[model samples]
Target: MNYAHLKEELIEYSKTIGIDKLGITTADPFLSLKDRLIAQQENNFASGFEHSNIDERVDPRLSVQQARTIISIAVAYPSKLKNPPKSLPGKRRGFFSRSSWGVDYHDVLNERLKKLEAFLEARCGPEAMMRMVDTGALSDRAVAERAGVGWSAKNTFIITEEFGSYVFLGNLITTIPFPVDKPLEDLCGSCTKCIDACPTGAIVEPGVLNAQVCLSYQTQTKGFMADEFRSKIGNHLYGWDTCQLVCPYNKKIPQPAHKEMEPDPEKVKPLLLPLLSLSNKEFKREFGHMAGSWRGKKPIQRNAIIALAHYKDQTALPKLVELMHDDPRPVIRGTAAWAIGKIGDSKKEENELLIAKKREEDQEVLEEIDKGLTLLGFAVEK
Candidate 1:
C-alpha cells in the first residue's frame, strides 16, 4: 500500500476497532522530561519502572528495528454520573475510578492492539513489523501529546481537548513511516484541583506524583496498609479518586463507555457484615476480575473493616470481633482491632482491647487497642 493510503486505512481501522482517538508521532517526545523521570525514581514513585529508558521501550530505530512512525490511541472512560458515592447520605453513587471499574484495561487494550497487529501483518506481510507497547519505557502520554490528541496536564495525565483527562492511552511502535502531528501544548494552566484534592498529599507538586503517597498505590499494595495513611482512606474500599474527581477536565465526560464498568448492584455499597467474614477463596472468586482485586483481598478486606469501624455501626461488632482474632492477615486483624473499638460494646470492646495489648507489635494496631480500652471505661497509661 502507498504510505499515505496505508496510514489513512490504519487510522480508520483503529476507529472501527473501538479506539476513540488515533494519531501518529515520529518519536516519543516526552524524552525531554528526564529530570522529572529521575525525580520519580529517586522519590520511589516510578511505578516500579524506569521512565528514563524511553529509547529502550519503543526505540523506532532500535527496538522496532527501523521504526519510522509511532501510532498512539486513546480510550475514553468519561463517567456521565459524576461524583463518587458520598461517604454521606443523599448523594450520587461513587464507585471505583471509571478507569478501573471494569475488566482491566491492560487486558482490553492489549487484545485490541493484537487484533490491529494481525490486520496490519496481513496487509503489509514481509514489508512491515509492528509492536504494541503499553506501560513500558515508552511515554504513552508523550506520544499521545505529540500526535496532537492531548496535552500532559499538571497531574501528569494526557488531557484530550475533547475528552479531557478521562482517557486511557495505548501506542503502537512500527517500522511504517507515516505523517506525524504536532504535539499539543500544556493545557493545565493555573489548575491546582488535582494537587489540592489529594488526601494523602501524593501530588507533592504540580505535574509530579509521589506514588508512595498515592492512595491508589496504597489501596492495591500487598501486605500492610500503612497505618499513618489509613485515616485518609476514608470510605474508599478499593481505589481512591479524590484528585481525578476534582479535575475540571473530568467534568461531564459521559459515564462508562462500556456498561461493564458500572458497579454490580450487589457489590455497590456492600454490607459490612458480609465482607468482615469473607473467606480468602470467596473473596478471590468475587473480586478477582475487577481492578480492585489487583492487590488481592487483604487490602479490600482491610478497607472494609476500617469503613465499618469508621461508620460506627454497632451491628457489625460481632463480625469485627471475629475478624480481629480470626483473620490470618495481621493488617486485617489490626484494622479489625481498631474497628472493634469503634463499634463493639463494652464486653466485646474489652476483649478486643486485651487482644490488642497482646499483639506486642504493629503500633497502629496498638493505638487502636488503646483507643478501645479508653472507650470501654478502662485506663492504661503507656
Candidate 2:
C-alpha cells in the first residue's frame, strides 16, 4: 500500500466532506499526556466526564490493534451567536455557551469520522481504523496537538491558526502507517489572560484546569450549584467562554462555514423565566437537539433561575415562587427559593418564602427558604 499517496488522498477528501483540518501522526503512546493526566486525576483537577481508563486514553495501539498512524480531524464551530437577544431586567435570557449552540458536536464530529473511516476502509479493507469523537477514550485535544492540527493553548483547547480554539476534534487510529506530521510550536507566549480571567480560578495554573470550580463544569452539575459559582455564573446557562474569549488567537476567528455548526440564536439564548416552567416534554422538544441539553433540563432550569436572580428580574418572582413551592425536584425548588430571596424585596415575596419555610420538608429547600426570609429581613425560627 502506498501510504504517502493515501495520505494526500485522505487530506483532499477531507476538504470535500466539511472537515476543516486534518493531520497525520504516529500511534505511539502519548507519554507526556499520560503523566499530566495521572497528576491531574491524583490532584482532583480532572473533570469526571472523561473516559476513566488512563491506559486506553494515551495509547492508540490499545484501542486499535497494530495502529501505526493516527488521523486527527477538526471541524470549526461558530463562536458568535447571530442576532443574540439582550438579557435585560424585565425580560431576562440565559445563553448556552458557543460550544453548545448548534447540533451536539459529538454527533457532528462522529458523522465526519464515520465518513473518514469508510474512505480508509475502502482502501485498507475492514478493521483498518477505529474512530472516536469527544467521548472516545483517547484525548481529542492531545491527539490533535500531536498531529499538527493545532497548538494546545494554555486554555487547554487545540487552537489552530485558521480557527482558534472554536473547533470540534475527532480522530481515527489506522493501520496504514501513514507518514507523520510534526506538532506545532506553542504560541501562547506569556499570556496569563485566560488564567487571570477565570472567575473561580479554575485555571489554577497555565494549562491545568481544576474542573471542579470551572463555571462550565459547575453549570452541568445535577445538584444545587456551589455558593461561589452560582453568583459567578451570571446569565450563562451552559458551559463558558471566558478562557477562549480572552485568548489572543480567538479575537479574529471566522464564523463556521459548516451549516450544522451555526447556532440558532433564539434557541441558544432563550428567555430565562419560561425555562423554569418548561415541562419535561416541552424542554425536550425545545432543547433536546442542543448539546447543552445533555444533562436534561434540570441543570438548565437551575441555571435559568440563577440567571433571573443575576438580573434581579422582578418579573420572574411569580414563576420562581411557583417553582419554589410546587416543583418536585429539590435542586429546582431550592434554587428557585434562593432566587426569590436574591431578587425579592416586597412583603408579597416575603410571605411566599415564609409560607414555603413552614411546610418545606426537604432540608435543603427549607434552608434555601430560610435564606430567602433572611434576605427579606425576616428572622427565621431557631
Candidate 3:
C-alpha cells in the first residue's frame, strides 16, 4: 500500500471536510506524558476528570490492538464574540469560556472523525481504526504533540501555528503504517503571559497545572465554592479562560473558519439573574448544546449565585433572599445567604438571614449563615 500517497489524499480530503489541521505519528507509547501524568497524580494536581489509569492514557496500542499510525486533527473555534450583549447594572452577565461557545466541539469533531474513519475503512478494513475525542482514554494533547499538529504550549494547549491555541483536537489510531510527522519547535521561549495571567495561579509552573486551584476547574465543581474563589470568579458562570486569553499565540490567530463555533452573544454571556431560576428543561434548552452544561444545572446555578455575589448586585437582593429562605439545595441556599451578606443592605436582609439561620439544619449552611452574619457585622446570639 502506498501509505504516503494515502496520507496526502487524506490531508486534501480533510481540508474539504473542514478539518483545519491534520498530522500523523506512529502510535508508540507516550513515555514523557506518562511521567507527567504520574507527577500530576502524585502532587494531587490532576482534575480527577481524567481517566485514572496511567497506562491506558499513554498507550494507543492498548486502546486499539496493533495500532501503527495515529492521525491527529484540529478544528479551530472562534475567540471573539460578534456582538456581545452589554453587562449593564441590574442586568449583570456571566462569561462562559471560549471553548464552550457555539455547538459543542465534541459532536462536531466526532462527525469529522466518523467521515475520516469511513475513508480509512474503505481503503483498509472496517476493523483497522479506532477514534477518540477529549473524553477518550488516550491523551488528545499527547497525540497532537506527537503528530506535529502543534507544540504543547506552557498553558498546556496545543498551539498550532495556523489555528494558534483555539483548536479542538481528536485522534484516530489505525493499523496502516504512514510516515510520521515531526513535532513542532516550541516557540514560547521566554513568555510567561499565561502563567502570570492565571487568576488563581493554577499554572504552578510552565506546562504544569494544579487543577484544584484553576478557576476554570473550580467553576465546574458542584459543591460550594471555596471562600477564596467566590470573589475571584467574577461574572464567570462556566469555565474561565484568563490563561488562554493571555497567550500570545491565541491573541494573533485569524478568525475561525468554522461558523458552527461562532458565539451567540446571548448564550455565552447570559444574564446572571435569570439563570438562578432556570427549570431543568429551561437550562437544557438554553445551554444543553454548549460544552459547559455537562455537569448539569446545579453547578451552573451555584456559579451563577457566585457571579451575582461577585458583582455585589444589590438589586438581586430579593431573589437571593428568596433563595436563602426557600431553595431546597443547601449549597444554593447557603451561597445565597453569603451573597446577601456580601451585598449588605444590612437592615433589609439581616433579619431574613437570622431567621433562616435559626431554622437551617445543614452544618455547612449554618457555617455560611454565620459567615454571612459576621460579614454583615451582626453578633451571633449562639
C-alpha-based local distance difference test score of model 1: 0.68
lDDT score for residue 149 of model 3: 95
Model 2 misplaced regions, further than 4 Å = none
Model 2 TM: 0.97
Reference-based lDDT, residue 97, model 1? 50
lDDT of 1 by residue, 185-289 (tens): 787888898887877778888878888878777766665566666667766676666776788987776554554455554454455456656677887776666
lDDT of all predictions: 0.68, 0.89, 0.90
Listed in order, each prediction's TM-score against the native is 0.85, 0.97, 0.98
**Higher-ranked by lDDT: 2 or 3:** 3
Clashes of each: 7, 0, 0
Number of the predicted model whose lDDT against the real structure is largest: 3
Q: Which should have the higher lDDT, number 1 or number 2? A: 2
lDDT of 1 at 278: 66
Clashing pairs in 2: none
Cα lDDT over the full model 2: 0.89
What's the CA error at residue 156 for candidate 3, in Å?
A: 0.9
Clashing pairs in 3: none
